[model samples]
Target: MNSLLIALVRALRSHCWLRLLGCAFILSSLGNGLTQVMVFGQLLRWNASPGTLTFAYMLATLPGFIGSVWGERLCRKMSPLRILILTEVFGMVALVFPLYGLLSHHIPALLVIQSAEALFSGMSYPALTLLFKRGLSAEELPAATAMETLIFSAQVLLGTGAGVLLFNVVSPLCILLLDALSFAASAILLLTTRKKFRVRDAQTMAADFPAHLPLHWKHYSPLQKRSILLLPALAAVGSPAMALLPALVQQIRPEETTGLALPLLFARSLGQLFGPLLLSADKLRQFSTSNRRILLCLVLFLGGYFLLSPLSAWPAVSLALIFSAHLASNVVFALGTFGVLQNFTSRQVATASALAWRGQVMVAGLATGAAGLLAESIGATGALYSISLASLTGVVILLWRYRT
Candidate 1:
């Protein structure tokens, strides 16, 4: 842990842009985490069926995949700073509907707002990736990513705990207002620091495009391509299980929904918090030679879903499993993936990042939608087991294809 902190400090000191981006990400993550809990709670309060909630999640995330394609194109035409600022502004605007929905008590408006926010949020990834690829040295990327994971985990802890507390004490509307303000603050910080960073078009840096490969796919190597394609499968493995959490909680303790769920959220956040420590720069370099470790972490992550399904009758055990699974998954999937992408040349990183993110959200949406249907038909436990098995199959395939 101390080594992780020292590495983060060194990475931040190495780049002024990283410090600026880190500040913005902190605020953005806090808002995102809080809004996620608040929105899920509100959906439950509205008596939304599992299918409805998961469908909404699917719709909200689908646009992100499309937006990611556009983001790559935009990266070539505009500066990363401009794209970031514009998307941030759009994100703030997208929140207005939710803010109004809170006052009007309209569920549909909130759903629409979620989808709109996702659209704007998705577009920001390419620009952010470009910034990281352009600004940070190869030596700094792993530490920088670990720092990001740590900050995000901290925000998840703060946001989930505080949002629930505030909702019970005050009103959900207050939480929405706070989330909007966080976006505004993040935008202001980015705008102010815009001039301090350099923005470059990733395409301009490439010496030549390969004639044999399709133009759009020319930037990625075979391993990078495999990595991007596998992201959705990895994402699908865990998303269904997570999407069914509210249903799982309601099944175990109907009256203590928020109370019981908060612990699970905290456990997940704790996993995320400590998960990145294993991905410190030195550790990442040590592990970069093989994908075997990542595949193993994913297998454990999926195994947790199967474990969780049986332990719903025992909340304590379920929570413990959740923590362990989430911690392992975050380390292998989240930080490990970023570390792999960072190994790519600067010219390839932005496109690889965008494509990987696009695949993740797209598959996650589909997986969530499927989870809802399965939960409605076969119950939450069945859905969890089904996704876990499916994810485990994906892991086996990955292991066979990408052997150490």
Candidate 2:
């Protein structure tokens, strides 16, 4: 743990531009954490049904597909720093509609504005990945990525807790205002890194991307191929369970509702922040390569889901279980992503990052839509159980085949 921290510190200290970018990321993540809590809280307050939440989530995420298509091309054409600035500027503008919605109590317009923001997010994310790939050396990637994930996750943890506290005491308009300010702040921070970034022409980009890159699917060893194929599916399985959380709280803890929702969200974010740290330990690093770690984390997730299914009504127990489940899931996700970022060529990184991101968004949107319908048909608890059980069975089959 000390070693990993030392490495992270060294990397950040050595790269002034990266340090600036990290600070910017921190501000953005803090705003994002608050936005998640505020948006859902407002929707529930406005008497939004499960179906409405589902549609909103779907609309918000699915638009990323279009944005990603544009983003892939933009990342190639423009300097990533330039793209990041534009996205943040647009994002700040996009928040205006939500701010207006809060002031005017216009639900439809709020939903539309929120969905529109996803487009900028989609474009910006790939550009962000390109920046890291171009800026850092290959040796610096794993630690840098780990540090980035931890920072975002930690900020999210603080953000959600703060959001909950502020929600109880303040107006939604205040929270939205802060969220907009975060975007503007992040953009200003990004602008300072201009000297470190330059637009690479087509010849330079092609020279960076080798024709016979090992990132191709057919080029991977058997185990690596299986891991790559299963990563997306593993990630997708947890989405529906997460989508059900707000409604589950409403169902099992009607008295507490939004009060409990924020804490549960906080627990999950806490898990995400710490999970990679666990795997970064020297002893755990051995397990990281053999697939044992991934399998164990998957089991942990399944076990937590099963237990939480029956006990979602108990606030304390549910918080712990949700934390453990998400922690395990994040570990698995981080491991797979680390492998990709470490191995991928600079040119391949943007495309792979965009595709992986787009896949997650589409799947989460669809899964949320499905979960909403299932919750309406059965109870939330039943929906949680059915979805998790199916996930476990699928993972088990996948692992069993990989073992052979």
Candidate 3:
């Protein structure tokens, strides 16, 4: 027990950027608490339809892509911190969001504000991620990740408790005001911690086109370019699944749509709580680090998808299973993608990561909208079947790649 405690302490102390990022994360956590329990819940009260809610989820990915592409260029020209601060200011204006809906009942305006929030996210993530990368030694990366995950988990736990508390009493407008203050304050804290960052490589400066590269693919790597090429498919993953819950409830139990749906979030969040522990295990480090663990995660995801498919018709049990699938997929995706990016040519990591994120967003939008259309045509069950088959097919392809 002492040895384990010492190891964690040593890992935290060793990484300078880790501490700064930790502080930043702490602030984001507090703000996120206000957003989720208050603003988002309020949106539900404001009559955000299931489809619109899916669009909001889709919007979450959009700004990040835009920011990432633009952020890279900006990161090269000035400090990423400065750009992040600009976003912080922009986000502060978002405090008026509740008013947007309150005065006019303009759901579109609320979504626009949501999109702006995402844009700020897009701008900040790639920059902030550098802190995570630089904060730990190669050997301690897992520990560093573990600490980070613990922070996020704690944040959600605290935020949820607080949100549930605050939501009952105050209007979402009050919560939005508090969220704005929290973010602005976080920005200030991050700015104060700015000395912890330094340019790590030439790539940290800007993304430039190689003179020898093809006209069509001048600014990105072949793999990265390919990832972008696959954006439509990737983004679809979340939209369908996330959006499905509303109609799933509507179909399964008409009167209790709101109440029963709570389990999906609860189950998902609970499953996620177990993720960092699994990834941080000493046993996992001994097992395999290359690609095997990630491949295993994908395989688990496929299985989970199949298990939770709507065709199973066991609502409560299937929801739990599907939540597990999501948690597992997120764990694997984080580990696999982080491993890959860490190995990327220094100049391309941010650019490639951005593109990959972009792909995720686009695919989420496409997936949700597609699920909606398909549900309209065949039903939610048919849509789930299709996605399940595709997820399994992806697993097979990944395994084949692992072999060859």
* Top TM-score model: 1
Please write out the lDDT profile of model 1 over residues 1-404, one tens digit for every residue.
43555777887887676788778767866777677777777877777777777776676677888788878777766777778778767777777777777779888777876677567667777667667666766766666567657655855676776776776677777787788888888888887667677433334434322323333666556555665665665677777877777777766677777677767877778777776675556666455435677767777776675676557678789788888888877775554456445656555665777787788897888788888889889887788778767766775676467543
Better model by TM-score: candidate 1 vs candidate 3: 1
Q: Write the residue-wise lDDT of candidate 3 on 1-404 in tens digits.
A: 22222445677687665566566656666666556555456555665555565566566556666877776566556666677677777777775764676568777666666677667766765554444454445555556445545455544455555666677688767777777777778777677666665544244344432434332346554444433333233234444665565555555565555455444554555555565455543443332243455546555555565455444456678667756765665564445344433444444544555655566666666666666667666766567567645644664454444331
After superposition, the stretches of candidate 1 with alpha carbons farther than 4 Å from their true spots are: 1-4, 151-155, 199-215, 285-291, 309-316
Which structure among the candidates has the greatest lDDT?
2
Query: TM-scores of all models?
Result: 0.89, 0.88, 0.77
Q: Which runs of model 3 end up more than 4 angstroms from their true locations?
A: 1-9, 36-40, 46-48, 143-161, 198-239, 280-323, 379-381, 391-395, 398-404
Residue 40 Cα positional deviation in candidate 3, in Å, after optimal superposition: 4.5
- Model 2 compared with the native: what TM-score? 0.88
Q: What are the Cα lDDT values of the candidates?
A: 0.70, 0.71, 0.56
Off by over 4 Å in 2: 1-4, 198-206, 209-231, 281-289, 396-404
Tell me how many clashing residue pairs each candidate has.
Answer: 0, 0, 7
- Candidate 2 residue-wise lDDT, 131-194, digit = tens: 7777777766666657656655855586787898898789888888888889889889889876
Better of 1 and 3 by lDDT: 1
